[model samples]
Target chain A: MHKTALFLAAALLACAAHAAAPKPAKPARSAADVLKDSPTSDWRALDPDNTLLMDLAAGQVIIELAPRFAPAHAANIRALAHGGYWDGLAIVRVQDNFVTQWGDPDGDDAAKARPLPAGASPKLPAEFSVPIERIGKSAGFTKLPDVDGWAPRAGFAQGFPVAADPRTGQAWLAHCYGMVGAGRSDAVDSSNGTELYVVIGHAPRGLDLNITVVGRVLKGMELLSALPRGTGAMGFYDKPEQRVGIQHVRLLADVPVAERPALQVLKTDSTTWQQLLDARRFRGGWYVHSPAHVDICSAGVPTRPAP
Target chain B: MHKTALFLAAALLACAAHAAAPKPAKPARSAADVLKDSPTSDWRALDPDNTLLMDLAAGQVIIELAPRFAPAHAANIRALAHGGYWDGLAIVRVQDNFVTQWGDPDGDDAAKARPLPAGASPKLPAEFSVPIERIGKSAGFTKLPDVDGWAPRAGFAQGFPVAADPRTGQAWLAHCYGMVGAGRSDAVDSSNGTELYVVIGHAPRGLDLNITVVGRVLKGMELLSALPRGTGAMGFYDKPEQRVGIQHVRLLADVPVAERPALQVLKTDSTTWQQLLDARRFRGGWYVHSPAHVDICSAGVPTRPAP
Candidate 1:
């Protein structure tokens, strides 16, 4: 809705102002322009320790964790990773326009549940919300210039999309597409960082600050996104054969250094990133008209092979 | 961004006034409360002329057109509907975290392209935006209380989700999940309403006001939403056998009266609708904490058997 207003306002202003002042016209800067002029320092390197590489038959997906936000879940997840908790698990749910969840398929039943590996916490306090102080000053939270109906401030923090409430002094990662969150039952504390789901449809912002978001799928999102929708309740595959098997999930540090994914996420604080946002904000050349506002989720973060 | 500021300001004002007064024993009213108190006169019924009934293997899907927003495309689509253009076409693309598109599988090749049947326009002006005057005063264009990065005023106009600019008096539909749009090539004017796509992922606001959005799938979205993703670029199926055939798409009025779907969408401007919105805006009972703001796309428009 915020983006809708910005888009209309920007377009109207441009059209009206352009007609009123035809000569020596100054063009409005697009999101791309802002990114183009941004300094390289705005970018940050991905911490390999915080990265997880999920290999599938199609390709490998890179996920960077938000340990600063969900430290406990991140730690437990790390333990699960090191212990190969998900090596034999399968993506058991692919609900169209909703999510794709993966974990121990038998976790739902208490009788046949998989045991938590050593180092993994059997239970932990819900890491849904955290103190805003944990968000480092250098996180490059380029706050969206528009107003949001959901949070006091909505923007990128430490390369992860986030929303915060100044009044509550609480901040949390938003449930944008590709964002990975720990799955839970009716109980708020039911999640144990073993069962996880990645948002694969509309940004379920409603889930923001309500669940612990561990990381975001940086690559191979297409592979997971393309999985067949499950037939059971909430998109769970009723039959075990309906699920897609996961080849493996390995931490970059655990693998041979040379075999790790060579990747770099564009620094959110860098000028290049700002320019990228601007470019998308203001469509040029081929675009007959440009939208004035850009939603935090609509903005794309560039990634590439490490230089 | 705009919504965030408004919420903060409101919260601040509420806090300041309550600082001196004893906390009221009653629950705090939410944005939904403001809407629930709206008069009954604000509500309106769906226009049968602008409605379409799409019967799928799973169930029925109802779509309401925004003729004022995209007249040319709507007209072309209506013609196609009458001519049974999509009677045997299939849903050919299901791009993960993106869209579910339906159209002639051979649209790319001119030789295989089906000619616009009698009464259908082979070429029509892109109906991306329309004059604001056409949107009536009784349209209930209550702008969202937030600032959008995309449009001047993002809100509902006559029960249809819309974006507008007061300055230019231009308005168009926003592309949210379940919203349908005409599919086209790189050429801005290529779409003639024969091919259609539905937003099934995060609101692709970038496409807002860029393409012609005809209507939204009112039900059975999961049927199309859950399809397997195509392997080809843009999520096109690599093999011809992969396409899911469309049994037929007929206007509800054209079908036998006894065969019509007995469904009704919650009147967007109704008190019940406002209460639903409030319920979501201030999820209280089970929720540990509620998100201060809710995205328009996430708002529920209830559907059930007509009384």
Candidate 2:
């Protein structure tokens, strides 16, 4: 009986010892890992109709339009693309830590400015925002779990970074890095999609709800961001020769099928996205302290080549 | 008596009419206007001993060191400058939407590595944060009005963006655009200030409290940020020819007095700075919606050539 008791105590001790031993920590899943493990259903292919393919001397810059937020501007942009309005135009302004603007260099000179295309409107009503109800909770709006200083609520809707105010019942595209907007005069309704600018520096959130944000760059932002900054006021190039010439600008639908970019954007509402957020929030390995927070602009939308 | 009474009634009516008339609205002051009106006392000249002047083929890039934050690292950097350690070295990495790193290309290869200067320490402890008491309210700590996700509290201290945790009693320099940091390996204390990088894109706040930030770029950021992004992994240039060569690096004090850069930085504690903040917060004219909040990084430390 004593021997049996000793054996039982020894077994219990062994169990306790095993339990006390520290197990090796599992490797933290990175955003890349989450993307690799994501199902095919979690990624959506770009609709050619809603895409713009702009070619510069450096490289191609692909942009995805956000018609739900700025329908009129998007439509006008499509018409302008079809009209090849920006084919030979130039990136006239590149303000360091601000934006890169591309349009007709003589846009301010009415006599020298190019005429608007038949389908493109000469003037557009400010499409700064739509009704909040249009992007209801039922929609694929993955809200960020953090406070934004500029917006009431911030999130991603249909692959675009957006801000919404339930109290005002308004939703608008945010001015995150790579966000494209229409440049306008002092008048609210002056912009007509002729002058477009891309945010290449920090997200100019103050511009949110103030300008007509039409789309965001899906790929090749480096081509635009790395351009030499203009020395003129507001970063306008002093000499016409300094402006970066555009090779071509076309709607992706107009491109040959074989030349179309095979790209996929991760769905923000997927489970893998949630894992990505957690991974960003609690960064492991080499990181001594993780703030348990991610800025709306910093939590970039992930993209990959289509399989 | 009737004529007198009629005159009195007329006077009263005139007074009432004057009171009812609306006052003309005052024109909003712009940031440029504020600077124009600023007193010389509101601007400070750069301290020659605390400045680094590096010449590339493009132009001169100036850096202002933060010795209070990382004294040992700063001392090591001063030694390096005296030894001309970075002379003829190359800018080897430029990650798009990230940093521009520079150092000896063969730093990792023991046989080909450049030797550290006589006074520069080969190994140093991580100087990520100092005691919060070091940067107390008594110091020139100007707290920002908006909330930041990365730090418990964020503000400017002596023209440098800084984050502090009162509870943890720690304060560290923030990783804002243009901010410079010492690049280390996986180990926290691995850096001896030989390799350095500058933030060239959006503020990577995730790096806060993780790496030792040493200084900030005072001028010529466009030269660094506009470099072609390296095509290799982590943005390292795959070929030696792709690396941008550094012509010379020297302490401003070491240079001839006439050759020193004459520059001034706006004092954050001045009344002009408050006006500048208000001007930025309440954008007028072209703006339709003014977001009252400004991110710490977006509220750039204004610098200009000395008049």
Candidate 3:
């Protein structure tokens, strides 16, 4: 087990299986190597209030909500989750190279849709974006070097990849792989935080501001992403049995201390994080030619075992 | 069965399910709708000479080798395919949001590795990229409006998403979702066309000139992308039973007429293709905001049920 952990650690740092590459006489240290030596202060644990745990037959999924950006949606989700609104729900959609959506499978059929528990908001004003000036004080906005096609500037805000339009003073979470958002109708304010989806493929950045993003899956994204693609409409499951059942949904705050997951995400604003990006943007190991630029979506936000 | 198809058509065209919002009286036609109206001439049939077919238990994966860019690798692959080089091999790795790699399970161990077929080339020099000027006249270089961080211009060249660095006068296939590349060791020229991996998530554009991208998966990407992620190092299956078995692989030319998949891909230079992009970029119907920009990866090359 110890040996396997060491291999996994090195593999994760490399980000690719370049283990077959012959080591140079004095191999230049890689980004993974730089991260391995990071200071303890470079990582931060999940805030229990913001962390939501989703249990499936395969495994537990970890999500860190962005209440600072979508307070109403986040709050509504918390209430619904605490009241066990989604305990027996099933994942209804898995579009290949797109998104995986889950909630009440009958969410479209109002007559059959499950009742919303009291205190859970049934509707939410489009919390598509938050003014950067408003959340700038509390949020950590670590800017990337390149300009984003979707917005004037792109970066990570409190661990979530984000795009910002400084002229409008607005910044919102980018729809990168693993991003979770409320599924909405044509109306901008239709999302009520019940039907939700997570991007499972290429970062559909154009969806920014068009959808109400809530959080991102920090772990077990594979449980959702790797599901069979539905042949039905919008990748919806045609048969009830095809849907994956949700065993339970619990906020970290509600879990007993002994049972909570031990997790910590690298601090995007830390010096270690900057070094990691530098190493990736200017890769040194095995690669013959290194690209000077890195896309915001391709730059993975590192997560590690908690302290 | 017919009802399900209609529902899927409407759902894909509508773009999303609006559970509560009033349906638009005259819903704006979407990218799907626009493509549905495209003239038959807009699409070209997949060339049997360039097409390669992979069979698995679940489905058949179709790939179109780009001889225009990586001819030597393409030629070697053709020779390997005709020799039944990949029969009974196993898909050994599935890294979530990364790639699905396949080939001989014992590839890394020379003692156990499968022998290179009688006529197959071994230790081919890296064919990472091609000069645009060399292939410029023969290939279609339909440039997108925006600049890619990795390259001065990005767009499609001969039906594949590509990036071009005008400064270097070189253009290479972008490592977008569904792209296939030769897996190699630390040595740049070590690849012998035996191991392969496909991009299953965000476009890893940084890898443009770092590795030899031989082709792109034209169909059945879901068969590979949606597989269970392996738990071992680099997402290799910890146990042999977990590996997905390959039935056979053959170039379309080697297959009889009855066995060939009838496929057509939209031509990049067609007016219909432009209209599709325009519809996606300046979405007319339900969306409140239509991004003026579209990332090269999001513009999926449309495929149709062949005539």
TM-score of chain A of each: 0.86, 0.89, 0.89
Q: Per-residue lDDT for A1-307 in model 1, tens only?
A: 1111111122222123123212212444554345444455555566778888888777788888888888888898888888888887889988867789999888878998877778999897888877877665756576665444456567787678887766778888888889999987657787888988999887877678667789898877877877777878778899999888888888777999778777778877665665565555556544555555556677657676665
Clashing pairs in 3: A21-B186
Candidate numbers sorted by TM-score from highest down:
2, 3, 1
Model 1 lDDT tens row, B72-135: 8887787787788887788888887678898888777899976667899867778887777665
Error of 3 at B64 (Å): 0.7
- List the candidate 1 regions with Cα displacement exceeding 4 Å: A1-46, A56-59, A230-233, A238-241, B1-48, B53-61, B140-143, B146-149, B185-189, B230-233, B236-242
User: How well does model 3 score by local distance difference test?
Assistant: 0.78
Q: Estimated TM-score per prediction?
A: 0.83, 0.90, 0.90
Q: Residue B257 in model 3: shift from native, Å?
A: 0.9
Off by over 4 Å in 2: A1-27, B1-28
Task: For candidate 1, please provide the TM-score of chain A on its own.
Answer: 0.86
Q: How good is the docking of model 3, as DockQ? A: 0.36
For every model in order, what is the iRMS? 6.6, 14.7, 7.2
lDDT of 1 at B167: 77
Worst 10-residue lDDT window for candidate 3 chain B reads B1-10
Higher-scoring candidate on DockQ, 1 or 2? 1
User: Local distance difference test, per candidate?
Assistant: 0.70, 0.80, 0.78
What digit string (tens of lDDT, one per residue) describes model 3 on residues A81-125?
888889999998898989999899877888999888889988889
Q: How would you encode candidate 2's per-residue C-alpha lDDT over B220-243 as one tens digit per residue? A: 999999999999988889999999
Predictions: Cα RMSD each: 6.2, 11.8, 7.1
